[model samples]
Target: MKQGARGSAEAGDRSPVAAVRVPAQPRAVDVDRERGIVSGAVRGEHTHSEQPLPRPRSAVQRSSVRGQILDALRTALVTGELRPGEVYSGPGLGERFGVSATPVREAMQQLALEGAVEVVPNRGFRVVERGTRELAELAEVRALIEVPVMLRLARSVPAERWAELWPLAEATVRAAASGCRATYAESDRAFHRALLALAGNEQLVQIAEDLHRRAQWPLVGRAAGRGRGRGELVADAAEHMALLEALIARDVDVVRVLVGEHFAGAV
Candidate 1:
């Protein structure tokens, strides 16, 4: 089972936010690898009678291959390309991605550890099902960790440091306005990751990110069904900017309230 954060501090006495270090965007090589795997069949490079044909095993970089497959699978999970309760076999996904099954299995195991998938006895892995109750529980946990941390950062971090996050915040809003769930989700994660990193606690940032990723999984199907429209996503983006502004202004009250409201309505 995953562990939650322990202990809390008063926001007023917390230290200022530190310099933010945003993760690098996914490289084109990763995208090209996934595209080759997923689209190879359509392009007649790795297909036979409409069936996917796996690429030959070569002395390619194993670590890079695994990372790319992981990225592709994560995207599928977040975009509803992989559905809840759907069983996906390692070899099956491997063939779809035009790679061998080893890397695919490795990738799935990592996802299983993250609670995104569960291993079956003889079958492959299944996407874990999440409903309203699960979502609420996730939101509550997020609020517990994020509310206090954000409030502390808002009080401590310099306004100039908070201002540095505007580009990421704006990117998220733009993604939402574009009405693309995948783009918005990626941007949303980036924005939050940047914000939380200011707390200068790596472990806390990781835990919060895990919760955020879990929260996003349930939205895939909804996003696909139009259950979450562009307006709602845009509103979400706007709230992110508002929260950043509040943090910059050192309004702990507004920051606290915004953090709670953000988690409550995140789904």
Candidate 2:
């Protein structure tokens, strides 16, 4: 959920780009827009044999393919798969994606615009890392943007809509109780998405979605596999319930305080 220094990224012996080798199964993607990095993969749902084993494939499959590749790439970058100062080439990535250079080039260009990749003269792209201070700033920006949005949604959203959210919150709790990190993580995200659904602001939702993706960068699925204790998980669930109650009551002060506390604890 946090970004680290480029020097920290450099310390690892493994080539940053090597981690981009996709597992056989689908995994999470974490993208840090503020730091221009991304990483993470799903965990706890698969054994080693079930990892997303990579294979050659065509980019012509569908728009989703490009989107998936972008997601995968973002996950890698955020998770340090493509670490800072690491060299990357479009053609090399095309080979990895089983596509021609065109799509890879296009994708890389898009990432560059997003500030995730830097084009070096006569070289390919390099994953740039942020300083600790920069990472902190990123977190601050997220807090500023998300806390208010959640509070506003809390005040305006109605009770019946909360029924839709309860199931997702329950799912997160169930996943946490079962020690299924990936499932828990997905459910956890779904719960928040459910809350945001009431906002009816497409641009805000998109922004929040991007921020959530960045938050995933720090630990990948590790958070799910080794989540908070059961009591803590229940407490978290209860907080959501409290939010719903406040929404049902149209208690703006209570909702704002609850959201602030929840995010302070969670983030």
Candidate 3:
């Protein structure tokens, strides 16, 4: 089967396979002396049977298949299509996604390492449970690590850089207002990534990337339906503009305050 496409049998499960099996008849029968009834008519009729399906591929057949699986899974993660603590069938997903089992298994392992999924002994992989409290804690962690890094960068980033970065930030806010959650969310992340790049610290950028990856898991889109008014978007733009101003002034303290307030308020 092509990677990421469902199999025909799985696409339409119309019947059970066990109902047509043939059983052997007993060559001899035993009679119950007291009840005068035959007790052993056929021993084959009581036999249990099982048929195992073939294992799906553990690796992708095509180079691009892995990335395709990743993107689909990422969307599902962000949209809550795969909720916390929900177990998924690797082969079943391969079937649904119209891919071989291999890419799904590989993707699941990567997600597990990211704390998006957990491996169980026998039950297999399940989505990691994340409570509102957990999200609040993540916000706190982001504030701690990110705010400082952003402030430091803001103090050094040139005004010309802001001209370039502001567009991404403005797009993020505008996307949110238009209820395009994925676009807004991705742009929001990109805006922070560009700001972090200004820090010139590779390690800090890497840490920020990991944190943002986790942040995408819980998602904030459906909530966008509540509406981010034009006024709200303008206010967010103002915040970004203020950060740029702080950068131009090389005011670390002001940048720090602004960065902290932005994330804290995002909650």
Candidate 4:
């Protein structure tokens, strides 16, 4: 007999019948337990075993968040929430605003490009410190660019075109009367931008805006400290309306004088 036949005969003789063995299939619970161990080890304490990880925000969502951060930061700068010469971390600002640090960082980078803040390596950003001399320099550059173009616009653009900007001018006056510095600053910017837009040169308008923003940074925390009253801002708004009226009247000489006086008094 063959060796397998001999072994089967011996088993049958000893036990009266042969017994067969089969392997057991893995259970669902055991499989799940193994997977849980792997996932928990990989994710550590920051993840749940049953829940999935969150996906990153989409590009559009990120862009919208960044824009919101930028606007909020601008408001903070204008309203003196972010003081000049003070250093701020992106994470800290994000925490305060209940957002992630990414948008705050992007916004700060934009503000840095606009000369509103300086980036510090290994740290964050410091608001640019402005002195009277620097403000004067900024005013001079603004005047040099704005005065000539405005005077030209006064002579060239039709009175009807100038009339279209009346709403923006009126808005500035109203904002000033409300005595809200942030609102007034924004309205003031709108008035200038609208005035510059009459020239129809986008580059010129952008440059003027940059200079205007730089000029405003220094006033962040100094309004109350310097005893500068809302009356001063109201007077400035009145002057803007007067300038618009002069432009509509095609009074180049008056516009020139007003532009000079405006820059002179800006500081």
Candidate 5:
């Protein structure tokens, strides 16, 4: 029956059946690409807090929600907005961030992997509190790793390379004067990275930056009970410039001394 029916339909059946044409339909819009998704350009009845946090840098626009949240949480950790030993729930933070808890939880787990926080079973993630001794040890280790590198770069690198870093050192100074610890801390890191990069050791830069970041955890308002405040940051930023100057002059003695003083005050 199937073969006979197929033969009759194809070979020219005189049946009076007419073919019906289907109409084309509009394509569906991807929900994530809709206006409110990416930029602050979201248009709708969203209240202020419901909007995404402003990302001043264009590079941040390319980041996923998880990466953005990670950065935001890191900034919170540094600025002491997220206090040490405090437990924060993913859903609660997600609401503040105008997103779902999935991204927040993902970001928090990344922080956990970085040793910045620890999971609290069903409760939430608790910020890891560092004692003075831990911070001191981190600073000591960082100094031991970086001081010799700086001295070597100063002695071997051309003066032109040191001059090229003036902008980075100056950036730290500007960030310090702006009274934003997070900003200054970033600039401070950039300067150190650029300095060590002259030695052509990629691993050295990564390790040094890791220690620097750990030293910066949960500072708890540098002016409050245990805060170091803006003055100390400004002084530290100024040392970057001073250290660069010594590096350019190829003053290994001065570079070693400056590097020592800088790390000594890191804790």
Candidate 6:
């Protein structure tokens, strides 16, 4: 019996049902001996790994032309190149940007929705004229809405979170130093947006941004040497960094005062 048990003993003793083996998956073919093809290895010389993400065909065709025109138009409005009450035609603006009028019209329709412009019967679109009083009132409303929210966030949001915002605040400073009102306008709003977003309220951020955009657009003569100076912008940007520091330190009093001082010059 013992001699019989020793004859190819282990293999003979094991049951087929008790044998262990790897789970099955479709095997990848090895194109060469270099061996990156067993599992989870990328293959495709034609569609290289470095390729950018694909976009929808419509987005690929239309977003660049229309999106850029919209941004340029808004920049013109912010910098006073597009004066209040002045009318512009899609074809005319399209000629300026060297594209077809369809995209320009599309962009202007979006601007109209934002309340930045109004459509004329057939003349085209006109910049919505806002008086100085309206501009100041918008500033007041922004401060009234944002200041309390910011204060609350300062108390609850961690210092680490505020620290993450240093780069955004610094972006505003760089924009301020550029001495271009349009550039600073965009960066300033970006900073405010990052701050307000921490409140976790989508509606609040949307309302605040609409007011900010309206306030950013130059009133009547604001860009005609009457707008805020480059030095003032630098000072304002400094206040942003300072307020961020105060928030990081959880100094509510300082945050309140800095926010007040900041909005005082917003219009």
lDDT for each candidate structure: 0.70, 0.55, 0.58, 0.68, 0.69, 0.71
- What TM-score against the true fold does each predicted structure earn? 0.74, 0.58, 0.67, 0.73, 0.75, 0.74
Tens digits of per-residue lDDT, candidate 5, 118-235, equal: 9876556788877777778999999889987887788799999889989998898899989887888788889988988888989999988888888888543332355557898899
Clashes of each: 2, 17, 9, 0, 2, 0
For model 2, residues 1-267, the per-residue Cα lDDT tens digits are 111334423432133234333234222232222334332112111111211223322223545556666755765554345556655654445435544334455677788877677876444666665454444455566678777877777666666776667777777767667653334445666777767767788787767666655554433233323324556656776787787778777788998888777766554
RMSD of each: 15.4, 11.8, 14.5, 22.7, 18.3, 23.8
Q: Which stretches of candidate 2 lie over 4 Å from their true place?
A: 1-64, 170-190, 218-254, 265-267
The candidate maximizing lDDT is: 6
Query: Which lDDT tens digits does candidate 4 get at residues 1-267?
Result: 111245533433353212221124233234335555322122221211111111111112333767866876786676656677777765445434445445567899999998889987545678776667787789999999998898888889999998999999899889989987778889999999988988889999998998887777645344436423589788998899899899999998999899889888887
- Which ten-residue region of model 1 has the weakest summed lDDT? 1-10
Expressed as tens digits, the lDDT of each residue in 150-207 for candidate 1 is 8778878999999999999999989999997767888998999999999899999899
Order the candidate numbers by lDDT, best to worst: 6, 1, 5, 4, 3, 2
Error of 1 at 76 (Å): 0.4
Best by TM-score: 5
What 10-residue stretch in candidate 6 is worst by lDDT?
47-56
Which stretches of model 5 miss by more than 4 angstroms? 1-63, 219-224
Cα deviation at 232, candidate 5, in Å, is 0.7
Question: In lDDT terms, how accurate is model 6?
Answer: 0.71
Candidate 6: tens digits of C-alpha lDDT, residues 60-115: 12336667667777887887666787776654454344454456678989999999
